[model samples]
Target: MSYREERRADAAAQAEQNRKAAEARAAQEREDRRLELETKLKAKEIAAEQKRRDAEAKAELARKEAEAKRRQELADKKVRAQEKERQAAARRARFGRVAGWLKANPATLFVAFVMVASIVPAVISQVGALSSAKVHVMLAALLAAMLEGGAWAITFMGKQAEDAGRETRKYRIATWLTAAAAAAVNFWHGLEAYAEHPWVAVVLGGSSLFAIYIWDMKTHGSHGKTREERRQEKARKKHLADRRKHHKEIAEEADRLLSALPFESITEEQAFETAWQIKRGTQPGLSAEIFAQVTGARVQLGAAFELGEHVRPELVRAGMLARLYNPLPGRLAEGIPTLGPSVPVPALQQAPEGATALAGIGVYGSEGASEKACEKASESASGNAGGNGSRGRSDEELEALLPKALKIAAELVAEGNQISGAALSKRLGIRRDDARRLRDRVIAERKLKLVEGQADAAVGA
Candidate 1:
């Protein structure tokens, strides 16, 4: 073979091999693209299935929610219906009770009917349901009904007042006037409605009068009260009188007990403590008046001591001597002269230094001179005799005067008057010491709480 021929054949063979290889490569690429499209289609089907399942779940949830909402609404409706039924039942019961009461009270029922009917004519007129002439007749009927009802009420009231022992003249007069007016109105209306038959007017007027008479007879009969009822009333009055008498006796006893204490021997503090103890120990509680009496006795004793020392020194000295010597004799001889329980005298040994003036019958030399000088100075300072020679008041007398003094003090305090020793002394006609004790007693008893400056202002005023 020629070399050129060989080259050309070899080239043809190479081209054929290249063509076959190119076709094989194109077939493999077409198979790969088909497999990729199948995979994409499968994934798309899977996603569509998942989306449909999600939609079904959402729709089911919504349906369940709607069902729950419907059930709740039904439950609320049932609750409301039950509440309404309960309210209706309560209203029915109340109405039944009212009907029973109205049925029992015929007079009250009649009055209620009249009052309701009185407004009906005006209502009919406003609604344009009645002619002018008919409206006037209705109004006249209403007036007659009102007057008759009023007369009945007044007659009943007068009878009740008379039964209760109250004056009934005014009620009787009102009933008479009302009955007359009712009869006149009824007769006038009857005549206007039935002019041809005069007997009708007379019958209407007579019927109203008869009704009033019947009501009066029913309310106020000849045998109004039985003998048994009268006896019971008398017994009740007697019981009340007995109760009043018992209370008065108890009060008197309490007053006596409160005033029985020897206030002159005890200090104010001791007296108050003893009084509180007695009050607590009392069976039937003590009255405020008893407490007032106790306070008054303490104040009076203190006042007598202070005033007697200055004004009636002789009496004070004699009282001191009696208190001292009387105790000495009892101490010296046991059971000597049997005297009733006497006020205990404080021992001279307990007296503080420089207080020998306070000892009974021991004021000598300078002490006596000082006491005389003090008496003269006080007498000159107070031109008034300081109530000299006046005997000390007994607890009973002091207690009797206490109420007026307390009332005055209360009035002064209520009027914004500051309470002080001086104010009390001047207003209550008491000595300064008595006023001071009274003020202290009131404060201790929680009757008043005066500020510091207020008491000073009261003294200056």
Candidate 2:
């Protein structure tokens, strides 16, 4: 405000302006430094995130590659298995074809041989016997006609077999049947010739015998049953048998199936599906893969059934009941010891706690075993059962079960005599260890016999 004060004031004002400018510059510099630090932190975070993303992408690519490789290997394995199965089926088909070819041609060759060797000799003898030698011409004509007929029949049969796509049995039966009829005709012709010419009749009789013997051996001896009888029996059995069995049988047939299932282990659901397939008569035969999966599980599960030292009461009772209900529908004829058709088998047989009997024989044959042995075994099992009967069984139920158990035990004795323990165990799904013990007990108790090993050389060699 004064001269000296004014100069001082001007200096003071300049100083104040300088102070403000310096403070402003300092604040701007601090702000720029803070921004630079923030930028550095953001850049570091972005680099870390980018690295993490790259690592995740790499892991994802590796997983995809591994999955693709696994799929390729599985596909290749399936293809190889199918190819092998196809080759085996082809071999069987070829062998069947060759066998069919041989069967059809043999009869023609046999007829040719007979005509050339025997017929010519007979004709020559007849010619010599002829008063005018014209009989030789007639004999030759007859031989030619017979040979032609044989040729026609052989050709017709071969063609029919090829066209019909049936097995060899039909052709064999037809050939033998026709030969038998022809032999009868030949015999009648011999009888006629005998009235006029005795020598000719002798030749014809010899031919007839040869023909009949060959035909009889071929038709009756080989087959054990006549073709027509077999056909009729099959039809009758089919008519009587429950059609449910047909579904199971058809599904088990080995044709019209391609691939096996794809599973390391099949669940009960899969088994149920398989049963449905069988029941529906849809797929024929399980593939080796499916079978392998099932058998592998079966081995793991081990033997689930028990074996008995004596006869099983349940089977015996069932068999007796079947006998009593003589001519009972479908299953009774099969002679299988099961609960009645109306009875819910699954419910009745659940966890099946009954005696393990000899499983090989039918009911009646089992009933005939030494009654003494049966009585002894039954008394023992019944005694044991009675001791345990405190668990609660009505008198009626016990009475019913005892008779049934006796019948089953008797059946087992008869069955054990016929089949070996191992076969019986396998058939009935019983444990081998249990079967062995039961077999030993039966033998020790005289319910079964143990035949000592015979000298193989003396018996068969």
Candidate 3:
């Protein structure tokens, strides 16, 4: 019984042990599966967190890009707006200037408007009239322009001439003729178009002429000068012509000056005045040769005055104020002093044999009639003038006049004159002593080639 029971119990224990081992293996496998699942879930969670952070960073970058693009677009728009405003301001300034100019010249604008209006219809009419087989339409269209162009060209020339102070009458006439030609063409066309309504032809013809007349009025009407202005203008023109005609030298020099400037900044008169100062040396209307002659005459007068102081002392005592006294043959009544220093008192009559300083003066001719008269009258007039004499000088006069006489003597000698002893005595009617003494002094001091001969024997010998 124990064996059987023991065997069954052992079997039972073995069975139980097998069952417990199976349960333990199943529990360990289940735990291992649970651990693997948990590890996979944590790994997946980590991956998902990293993807979320990446998505957030991508979204932030996109937002910043959008914000930057928006800011750049706003800046570009602002720049465009500023440029548009500047352009608008420039346009306003330009428009304002144009308005100012239009307002300033209303008459000019009106005239220009009328002229343009007149030309357009005239051109169309001309083209219509001439656009047949012979004339091309383009060439015909240019005909009205040619007519108006000629008139305006003449008008322009007239204006330039008026501004330069030139004659504009011919230009005005030419301008009128040219305008009339244009007006005639227009009238012919107008008449052809409206033969029954002549006023329409008149209007078409007068429009072009009227336009040109207004321009002529503007150019030539306001230049009428008053009397004084006209006088000055006439005088200036005459003076200008005279200067050109009479003063050719100055005009040539002025031409040179004007050429140098090339633009003609200086007036002809101004250039002539400068040239006059250069060429004449003196003021205008005076000559250098005449002035020099006047100067020399004054010098000779001074020399005569200086020499008169050395007359004889006896003559001074005899009521002669000057040392020398030789009154004119008839003017002794005026007092010897009253004859004045300016008169050309003849020297005492010299012997007629040789020439004296006064020779060839034409005052006394070669016949010696005046000399004979002087000597004859002096012989009767001495009264009691001096020893041996008619009217004589003292010996004292000779010594005193020597110093002052040198220059006079030198001048006389330079003039081809020689004052000998007899010539001195005869010229002054002085006592022989003083005449010979003074004459010898002059000859020695001036080194003159004069021979003093026997004086009283030498009269016309």
Point to the candidate with the largest lDDT. 3
Q: 139-226 in candidate 2: lDDT tens per residue? A: 7456544543453365367557655775656655555465444444444555554667766656653553354344434434664778
- Where model 3 places Cα greater than 4 Å from the true spot, the runs are 1-49, 120-145, 149-174, 185-202, 216-461
TM-score of 3: 0.34
lDDT of 3 by residue, 74-183 (tens): 99999999999999999999998889889987877887887788766766666665664368877877776788788889898988897898998999899889889878
Least well predicted 10-residue stretch by lDDT in candidate 3: 358-367
- Model 1's number of clashes is 0
For residue 348, model 3's alpha carbon misses the true position, in angstroms, by 72
Checking candidate 3 for backbone clashes, the offending pairs are 311-323, 311-324, 347-427, 348-426, 348-427, 348-428
Candidate 1, 26-99: lDDT as tens digits:
88899889999999999999999999999999999999999999999999999999999999999999998898
How much lDDT does candidate 2 score? 0.47
TM-score for each predicted model, relative to the true structure: 0.34, 0.27, 0.34
For every candidate structure, what is the RMSD over all alpha carbons to the true structure, in angstroms?
Answer: 22.3, 29.4, 24.1
